[model samples]
Target: AHIITAVIGSGVLSLAWAIAQLGWAAGPAIMLLFALVIYYTSTLLAECYRSGDPETGKRHYTYMDAVRSYLPGTKVKLCGVIQYANLVGVAIGYTIAASISMRAVRRADCFHYHDVRGRSGKDSCKSSSNPYMIVFGVVQILFSQIPDFDQIWWLSIVAAVMSFTYSTIGLGLGIAQTVANGGIQGSLTGLSVGPGVTSMQKVWRSLQAFGNIAFAYSYSIILIEIQDTVKAPPPSEAKVMKKATGISVATTTVFYMLCGCMGYAAFGDAAPDNLLTGFGFYEPFWLLDVAN
Candidate 1:
């Protein structure tokens, strides 16, 4: 559950759009490569948890603790600063993503009502993401106040369920839409070779896709913290951590492929940054958009 909460989040939603940018072949390949890299790094982090002969007393409970134990001088402080800064950035990013999702839901609801009333000018129901971001940020701040890890078990469970729920909805809608539409959009070419003007531009765009995949697979910063929660002996925690990481990565990879491939197949070049928002006011899809 902890691994699931750590790995699968709003990031999954943009994967299809990322794939669209990278084309079909390179996108899945890059994401799978990221999964491998994440797994490797996670094992390295697990190994860092213990020192000496593994049966010895040394054990680091947090990322900074691990850094301080392993590194010397200013390097420890630098790692600490970078780690916390990354966490802050992640928090802000998630809040902004939640606001975007909320805005998509709002737009879908407005369009649905407009269509039902048979009266539509421009979408008069104007709103900004600021209020939604504030609401999400407040909720996160409240959740952050829970000092005990054990006390947050329910929160982790809830988050894992929500992640699975929305992912399933998004994938189902994509597949359904693809079938109903009877074919894919844009180029059926295997590799999105060059949607850009110049070859150099295409190469740079592909590199950007690689970066997106890397960012999506990054949970290394929290691997130590999650492993610390396992109720096992020092030496055995590595095994526990490996098993948990394997399962989580495997599960998330399947969802990512399904959502990315099906979404790209359905929408192709038209895929939006948020796949749910790209759906517009389409029938039953509006519900999926809202749920996602």
Candidate 2:
């Protein structure tokens, strides 16, 4: 769910988008950073998972619960904060897609619009913007539940994730739709940066942009997860789980860096906005049709 939000708001290749604004030499550096962030995120998660809390006989003492306890507030206030943040996050979801769309349309010189008009006729899913998410998140969430077993807690998390997403729209869109739309209007607002930046320049920027967004998204996600765990406390085996989370982050970082490097190597001077898929030519092991 969070990754979906990141993709919509920042657009893929946000690392490349930012780097293209720099120059060609940024290729190696951006990849390195992506790897590092992945490391921190994964590491912290593992630590949280491994370093289990010796079960203080408290139900609300998960990872997230601990952090909030220090604030000296009522439980009601804490829950309110979480709800508020998510509401604001909903706006972010729409704004991200809007920003990327605006930029893409402008970059095409207003020639290749091809807006994604959903049944509502407001937005389209032409670029897997919402389809991949809807399918994976919604469909998978449903499929994950076969017999709707005799478990109570298990059923709740599934419901939480499902409840979070709203048909790919903004939170206060009706009221702040104008502001949200304006935030991304800069995609085509500024004067031309130059007389057509090189394709490599574009590719480099695309990779850079992606790396940056992924780094932020991954990092933020981890931090948030850890905080939640620490505050709220995980199950009895939470400590053991921390180690696994840490290992996953470590592995994820290395994989992300490799993905970036391979991307640069393959795209060299002709990388597209979504270069991760394009970079697959150099990575025979990557078995997905992300480029499609």
Candidate 3:
């Protein structure tokens, strides 16, 4: 559950745009490659949990501890600072995504009501995403007050379920859109590029897509922290961590493929950065946007 909570997030929503940037063939391949790489790195980190005899002394409870045990002098502090900074960046990114999603949902709801009433409702809500981001940040601050990792097991479980819920909804909507459109928007080869994009620009866009895929798959900074929460016999935490990593990665990969492939099939080069936003304020989509 912890692994799932860490691995799946708002990043999955933009995967279609990433794939659109890379094309169909390269997009899914890159995502699968990222999954494999992350799995390998997670197992490597799991192995670092215990440095000596498991029944004896000295286990690395956190990522910085592992770095400290292996590195010298200021390098240990440097690693700690870097890891925390990466985590903070991840947190900020997610918060911004949540705010954007909330804004989308609100717009969708307003549009839906406008459609039902046969009138425009654009001026109903004048709020921007910053307010929602601030609210989410405050909520995160409250959650952060929980000092113990183990104490948040239930929260992790809830987050995992929510992740699955929204992902399933996205996959289902993608399938529906594909069927309604009678086929994919682009050719089967999926090699199309956005309008006015030059050949050189294509290369840069593909590289950006690669970086986005890498960023989406990155959860190594938290692997050791999650592993530390496992209750197992000495040295067996690696086994538990391996199991969690496999399950989370496998499940998330399926969802990623569905979102990327089906989303591109539906929108082609016009795919938005947030897949859900492209659907607009339609029935059921508004609900899905709310759920997301």
Quote each prediction's TM-score: 0.90, 0.41, 0.91
lDDT of 1 by residue, 109-205 (tens): 7777787888876358567999999999888779678778455668789989988888778787788778878997645433345454566755676
Q: Candidate 2: global Cα-lDDT? A: 0.38
On residues 1-292, what C-alpha lDDT tens digit does candidate 2 reach at each position?
A: 2222222222323333333333345444554555566555545443343233445443332435544544456764776577567646654554444444433433332222333222342234224344444444565457668674422434544432432222111121211323433432212111123567666655565655654545433433333333333443444434544454455444433433333333333333333444322221222111112122
Which candidate has the top score in TM-score?
Answer: 3
TM-score for candidate 1: 0.90
Candidate 2 weakest ten by summed lDDT: 166-175
lDDT of 3 by residue, 55-163 (tens): 3447788898888777897998888889989988998888988887788788777776777788965678445899999999999889778777457559889988998
- lDDT score of residue 116 within candidate 3: 76
Tell me the alpha-carbon RMSD of every candidate: 2.5, 13.5, 2.3
Report clashes for each candidate as comma-separated counts: 0, 53, 0
10 residues in a row with least lDDT, candidate 3 = 185-194
Return the clash pairs for model 1, or none.
none
Candidate 3 off by > 4 Å: 54-57, 121-127, 146-150, 187-195, 278-281
